[model samples]
Target: MNVILRRLGMALLILFLAGPAYAQIDTAAREAYLVDATTGTVLLDKDGERAMPPASMSKIMTVYAVLDRIRQGRLSLEYTLPVSERAWRMGGSKMFVEIGDDIRVEDLLRGVIVQSGNDACVVLAEGLSGSEEAFANELNRLADDIGLRDSAFRNATGWPAEGHVMSARDLAHLAHRLITDFPDHYHYYSELEFTWNDIRQSNRNPLLYRNVGADGLKTGHTEEAGYGLTASAVQNDRRLILVVTGLESQRQRAEEAERLMRWGFREFENFELFEAGAMIEEADVWLGASSTVPLVAQNDVLVTMRHAAREEMTAKVVYDGPIAAPLQAGQQIATLRIEGPGIAGHEVPLVAGVDVPPAGYFQRIYQKARYLLLERQ
Candidate 1:
């Protein structure tokens, strides 16, 4: 049985006993979420987990589904898809694709991403799964594999339909995945405009045109869903993904996206708390040659939090002890959990710094008897 202990070891270093205080932001969006992409720290969450209509913002998933197929060698950027009557009849946004025309895959991606073309989505869906409805089933399967728990996709176009929904957190996660998983295709989100068939349409994402480091993602709008945007940006190699939905207008969407992006980047920063192989403390061992085993980290432990919370955060060493003997060096023996205001929760693994072989047989027996006798006392 593992004994639970909350006591800090002799190596307690950081001062962190005060009450916790996380950062907060005022947002006009009905749903908003901001996170540090590199560290997976959630900086802001306001109705972020609640499922709602994502409007065209759902196109990001459609695009993701296509990109994944490309990665699996089932599709290629050079592949062409035929525009069907269903696609040509699609309403809302338009890629101006003509029926019976075979459009290149690259062009279709641009049409869907840059123009938010419902029709382009249908073409890609039809080409991939023989129909948009079938492709939507494939999308749900792919979404499950990608770990989207609260999203349900009913159409490739993100058109108004029952049971079509996504949480802000899910959307932000999708944005982060696109940036990290598809470096080659991610550049498409940054394109300012695309021209096809004598028509030019600018990308709908407002962040791309601004001075901020924002790059890729999509925007969604419907009378029921309002305006929403899934945006990601990098400042100094640290990326932050922001998802906002239910804004009043296009201008509000632009303003809220920029404001949240600025707030997230400016308020949060990454700090390394411990280096790899650094000794943190010593944990007691049971019936071992040595009474204590040095505890150390196996990797760098870095945390992202508000700048003000660095001094307030407390680090605690938690482990079951006295740890049993016969342990090899580098065996994980404890967790270094951190908590405080403006800080995201983190639990860094602390491993044994040295071998802990069992004590001699007689010594083990003697220790056991002594422990039993002491228990009686």
Candidate 2:
């Protein structure tokens, strides 16, 4: 059989649009990353891998670590952890728990998530792992397991330290995990406000305050790290995760994050390309009971791209043919490659859609003779 690659313009309705995948926009952050949660497509990236101070944004990981323990049945929301002197003495944000007081896991989680309480994070850390230092080890281990390639945690709170750091991509990945992995607990990030010990504070995430379908996320700021945010939102049933750091102020962080979120949802969209078992091609068969075998995918194919770029997409069918018969239905054989402007590229497996048993003895012999005659000519 010889390799054959055929343009699928006739077989496929690939929309060819004008312009790039998405329009480019300027940003103020030193590092940034944006991704669509529904399709897992990265829409924007700027110095995304460069690890920098994440400030309180690292609290997301701390919350993740604590939630992981709860997820494993090692702890529960009803359980309580004692606040240590170290936890009480922590200088940044506070849940205001008295030293030696036992606090509920539920409230402590809120303190870290909605309140950005440094003291609360330390309490959860020491309670879960016996010490904050030891808990940092657990956080790193969990980070490795979760693919946090450019993150290093020296403490539960994202305090300014010489080596403590996280990249925008790492923060965005963490946000995605929180939203997808712990759906039951993710509501904490969306809480408009939380009160503990007669003190209340609103969620610092700017997107949550707006009507742009934003919910759940954390914001951060420190002299060394400037201001930062890691957030997610759903608009028109589409979810997007964004991580940005190194802005100059709180206002800049909110404005920039919201603008990027709106831009991402406006520019990109999810498209259903094909359904499972859809006949993608009718491939010729050699010495078979049937003249051709249908080709199909095992599952549906979907892609995300900018509006103009989707119109410019192209597709093709590729296979080694003429395929020998006795082919069975659903036999994996061919490939479908799809490409377009603003799309990196996508490939779907094409399987044999129908059976084609070998032909009768006389028919087989006739096909073999015909092949030889054609080759000689």
Candidate 3:
């Protein structure tokens, strides 16, 4: 009886411990979120979707739309934009571009990114769309397409306006999209120094220099909005995005951003879900040149999880099975899902490893004949 009671007590104790194990969730951040940029996993969130004044950080969307135009061949970086009186009159964070002066698009971008130049933003807007109002419309359109549901833009320069608001989660999502979608153009945000017409300025994101792995992002401030920063850092191959808004001072913004980044690095680790071009699994090919084709991920798949729970994770590949032939090498074919306790599941796209052309009529006939002959043997 004593032994049986001890065994039952052990079972009850195990259940008690297991119950809390499943309840352990990462709910850090007072008004913030940490996401896996590649996989879109919400690692942590606190009022993440609530809208608030973004201040100058709204310029990130403006830059994204401009860069998109450049990539689409609608505009060139070398194209010269004429500054207007309206552009020069922008109040906060001026690049000081004089009216009637011609500035290259590249230079203006540097001014806007490194110096947070409202003047530069206006110049780009007018240069691209012939008016800032029209450009603001385009910004709103782009925001809609990119899933920034809570954001709206009333001006191209993110000047104080009634509808110019974005949530911290939205800004972090935008920052991630900027970095991942346009790595070539994203370097402009991290530029520490930029000089225009003999005026030198530096990026306002202070954590860039002080934090170990801090890089590209933006800063904002106004009497109404207070000081805020959207900061990102990569450490030990794991990247984290942090957005802090409504702080008292620039120093406080920087300190809090760094603190949050450190907490992310210390508490969580990135787990690779799939490797680029690596075959995740095989897909059956019917009536094709090959009997089976391999599905792969176009890029490395990764997710952030708490460090202590790394060993308890499982990765599963999910996709339509036995995909038809004539498959293109880069076609998306599947998704890799990573599951673990205390961490949300993350899914990333898997692509075809190699092109597989459909078998010709004659090839199919030959295959059938060979199969029949082999069976007869």
| lDDT (tens digit, per residue) of candidate 3 on 1-377 | 01111120111000110111222233223366666564565655667888888888888888999889888899888999999999998888988899899999999888888999999999999988889889999998999888897898888777888978889889998999888888898888778898887888888888889855877788988887788888888876667787877788777777777776787678666666556777656666656789777767777766555655535555656655446678888888666665666545656667778889989999888867876786698
After superposition, the stretches of candidate 1 with alpha carbons farther than 4 Å from their true spots are 1-20, 287-292, 343-345, 353-377
lDDT of 2 by residue, 1-377 (tens): 12334431223323443355566578998898999886667888899999999999999999998889889999999999998898999998877878989999999999998889999999998898988889999999999999999999999999998789999999999999988899999988899899998998888888988777988799999998999999899977789999888899889988999999988988888877678888767777789987678888898776788766634667666677778889988897777777766556667788999888999999999988987997798
Sorted by TM-score (best first), the order is 1, 2, 3
In model 2, which regions exceed 4 Å deviation?
1-18, 282-294, 317-335, 349-377
Q: Which candidate leads in TM-score?
A: 1
lDDT of 3 at 198: 88
What lDDT score is found at residue 120 in candidate 1?
96
Q: Between the candidate structures 1 and 2, which one is better when assessed by lDDT?
A: 1
Count clashing residue pairs in model 1: 3
Top of the candidates by lDDT: 1
TM-scores of all predicted structures: 0.88, 0.86, 0.75
lDDT of 1 at 217: 89
Global lDDT of each candidate: 0.87, 0.85, 0.76
Q: By lDDT, is 1 or 3 better?
A: 1
Cα deviation of 54, candidate 1, in Å: 0.3
